[model samples]
Target: MEGGSSTSGGRSWSIYGRAEITARYEILGSVGSGTYSDVYRARRLSDGLAVALKEVHDYQSSVREIEALQALHGSPNVVDLIEYFWQEDEDAVLVLEFLQTDLETVIREGKRRDGGIEVGEVKQWMVQILRGVDACHRRGIMHRDLKPSNLLIGADGVLKLADFGQSRILNEFEQIPTNEEWMPQPPTIDQGVSHPSVGGYENQAAQEQRPFNQEDYLQQLVDFKTRYGTNDADKESNLQDGDASCLATCSTGDMEDDPYKGSYSFVAEESAEHESGTLTSYVGTRWFRAPELLFGSVSYGLEIDLWSLGCIFAELLSLKPLFPGTSDIDQLGKIISVLGDLTEESCPGCSKLPDYNKISFNKVENPIGLIACLPNRSPSEVNLVKRLVCYDPASRATTMELLLDTYFTEEEPLPTPLSELKVPSTKTTHDGGSLGEFYNYGNMESDSDLEEFGPMDISTTERGFSIRFS
Candidate 1:
């Protein structure tokens, strides 16, 4: 996609082409695509300001995310969406405020190269994440997906929650409606005893029944084969493959007819709608999958987000994912190993989840002892992790509880804002040209670059103040 100029209402503005935006963002040089959406580093042509751009192919998903983000503006801890553009023939482009790094990068770097993050720093990071999440919840929104990669660190060292794509906005009555048309319905079936020679009512049934579309069935079978890589013949003969669990659950009576069954669907229907309000879908990096989702809970809400946060926090502390299973069953086992077994008493609502009856439970072994796994963590740090990782949604701590925890209060002051932090100047060759012994010229070049790369001529004071990187 390329960014270009466009007119909205009566005002004219330059919009970078989708392709141009991707190139300008310069992310191609840093990391391979890590998300379903294509990401890039982009520069605003009007003022030459740098920002990140994400191009979404699905129009519905794009609009949903944009609406959610617009509601979150003015939040200190939330990542800001600078601008968005859509055209009939092109993918939606979301221009976002650029950030220096994400928590995932920081964790990996600290673990492999610089040892682990200091205990105080971990507490500070958690405090920032909780504050951001709290702000969202206060505004009647649930992040739904709270992973390390989604937490972005700005150039000013401020942590902001990005990716509202999976976020859900609650109304004043604290309810969200589900789209009924997307719900899956149970398949009708006929059952009867049969004998070898008794071809009873075959012709009569053919005359009374509507003709089934073989092509449509074939297409569905093809899609299933492509997704699961299972042979159609094998599926026809016996549907016992582990990979077929999701399909089996959906096909059988185990799953609900309503798609939004596990979501927050009880919100009153007559409540006033915000300028924009809608429930988002399940979206998160693979490793952060919540047990409720994996087990096929239909109407789950913020509890899923808390699960992801726990996983992220654990990874941050141990430098390894707490549950790194490859499949749903494996993922559940990983979680069970850490949290102990899930019994009827421990997980009261387990039977309500789809496919719950299919799997049997055994005494779960704690593979990695909490403190031993996070060898670098202190006692307080361990306590915080336990609170966040609680299996029961009601038992999990709220954002406020986390922020007020002793970890953040007792930690040393956070690092100075990146905007105020000075960058040391060092002599270097520029395009094979020597600039040494030319102090006056170097100073002039620096000023010129600053002016050219500064904020747009339009005042952003109304929106927010810019952080000056010295």
Candidate 2:
């Protein structure tokens, strides 16, 4: 069969060069596009059920997402993965449940309809978001990116976490050895042997006819580990640091005299697969990035997600981003402006961060507190945010703890009933290509479509470094 094709409401949809998938599901329309994948809304031919066909272009991202989804199967508030097709030397196509809209859309629509989302509605959304996050954390998974766009909502008013490309399973950290000799080698699958398929099976009698060689298996395992596993040098260095410990935005030039000030394109860097016990700091959007991540701390945990949650919660209360910074340096400047300086006292052990000393800043005498960020909002709302957005990751409240806070219990305006939620009308995927609607929003995607931040200037004066925000 020619790669499946269909047209809906004068829009055409086609899946290119995948005959096996085409035979099973009919491509409906493009949902969104990302740096590593393109998501399409499709229909299963067997039962006429609608599902999302995620065409993952990056092999590592695909593996991470598939592994996460399988482990998180049946989790509450987590997106459901129906099935997937992975053939050698080709992109993996994951069939997932299609969610109508996302939290970002809800926030935008609420802004347009009313001045802000109703207090009760905001509470309900937060509850659902927390539930999704709790599920991930309980399973030892850190959704490195937890911005509004990644939180999907269905007609049933349920919020499900999606986009596991940046997710990391903490299990590897537990498995990593403290000594060189104790390092365990990874299992190697022989190339000559075809991997088992999810839908098909091999004949047992034919497989039994083949001779097994223990010595060859051991040699191949050693060879594979030597080529792909961690090198002796990396192992030694990484282990030494074990005692110690640890997105994307088109950034403005830090200096006014910089030549690349006016013209800067947002180039998304490919996420590198990290060695066990280490993580890439380049994860999540700049606005929701945690202070540790900002300071270049590689060793982190679920607390990073908590900080992003705090940002998202703040946005819901105010209907705008808590700190909308243009550049990495500027982002830190905005945060420090509101939360004061990052210090040993404010955040114990913060100085130990990799780049904490590298990036210095002028102390803020009068820091604009979280309450000031949420004007007219109840104290409960501010308390909820304060527990998450802090200098110390260890101090950030866990999702389960947040779920039990008075914000959700004993509050005057309780969480809105799920049945009463106004489900957003599902918009058809754009035929004339739009930015990352299915996975992420393009550069323009944010709570506010306000004009981009003006050019910022970073001064390296003897007093202290400061990025002038316009």
Candidate 3:
């Protein structure tokens, strides 16, 4: 689909009335815009073939995106880069295969109170997303920013990974080790017995089982309330006032702001061994940013993207972000409050992060309960997401492991094919008519990244806060 000649093979229409690229591609209209480029629907003069032309204005950023697409040329579940060429005082013209729309549009247009999309549709999209990520990882690359917007759809409903603006090369990254000593192992099948030495030590491994006692649990809760400075009168009053009011009065003793209060120490344990491109920390979008990234981890690798994927899956299930913090500090507060108080065991070496102790935060435990946030998800589905979005990036599931999760093998909600997706296959973008509505680019002056932060990569850092990259 070269533009050297017109349909007559002599000369083409000069600048299809927009830019020099119009000589080759007939500009239809604007499709969408990124931080560094504006995508337009166009048709080639040689064959009248439809394509997407991304007008990349920044040189360095464009190079990174080009390198990523070139490395993943023929990989499965990834978009194809048709052709690319640059002009001297203008933007670089990147011709890509046209997609019907992106996953972001689908999610937004279909938002509902009854927990977003159906289970089958989410399962299908999850499979496709993981497959695309696996392809990238296998080739030693990391698609740093993988929000819904980056997942594109075709006329036939086939989904593919697109927009490598924030992607990075991993030529010498460490392999995900099979010797997962740090990961928890499945319990062995064995007989269980009660021990008189311990208090009510009943094991599920045994043939017989006994349900837990609720009265005793309440007594323990009362003790916990007592230790935190609440009186017995308050507890009695709470019982009469109802459970919701009772919980509002409970305290956590004191915040963990004092370094000497606990035996925990900030220990340095390098999680991954990436050789280069390691310092630039701003990775995925704000709400999807991993705990390690918020805590200031500059050496993280592919697992960071996995955390973002976990958030995306959660959003698909609930029709909202799992952690939608307005700022970085607020983001951490939301994570601990919803995911339960993080410890060294929960996130090994988390204290060693550069910004770990930079601010003082009151210890906020999960009041409504961790599982309460995901009430509708099955146990296996919840378990899978918990592992991927866990505090420790090193322990996150690889793309292949996620794709092979038992949740996919279950009999109930099977994945739906693209042809069955209830969305139109030929629609384009509608994000037009506003300056503030631009895509997430490097808001370095405000928010940044071409797409590493992604379309919804809102700023999380407060003004004048001394936080490291990412």
Identify the superior model by TM-score, candidate 1 or candidate 3.
Answer: 3
lDDT of 3 by residue, 67-103 (tens): 6676566555888776676544334556888877667
Candidate of highest lDDT: 2
List the candidates ranked by TM-score, beginning with the highest.
2, 3, 1
What C-alpha lDDT, on a 0 to 100 scale, does residue 468 get in candidate 3? 20
Q: Candidate 1 — worst ten consecutive residues by lDDT sum?
A: 439-448
Question: 108-141, model 2: which lDDT tens digit per residue?
Answer: 7777785568888899999999988876765557
Backbone clashes in model 2: 2
Candidate 2 or 1, higher TM-score: 2
TM-score of 3: 0.66
What is the RMSD of candidate 1? 24.4
Cα deviation in Å at residue 31, candidate 1? 7.1
Q: Write the per-residue lDDT of candidate 1 for residues 367-416, one digit (tens) a residue.
A: 45566656767677677777767666555666665665556765555433
Answer with 1 or 3, whichever has the higher lDDT.
3
TM-score of candidate 1 against the unseen true structure: 0.60
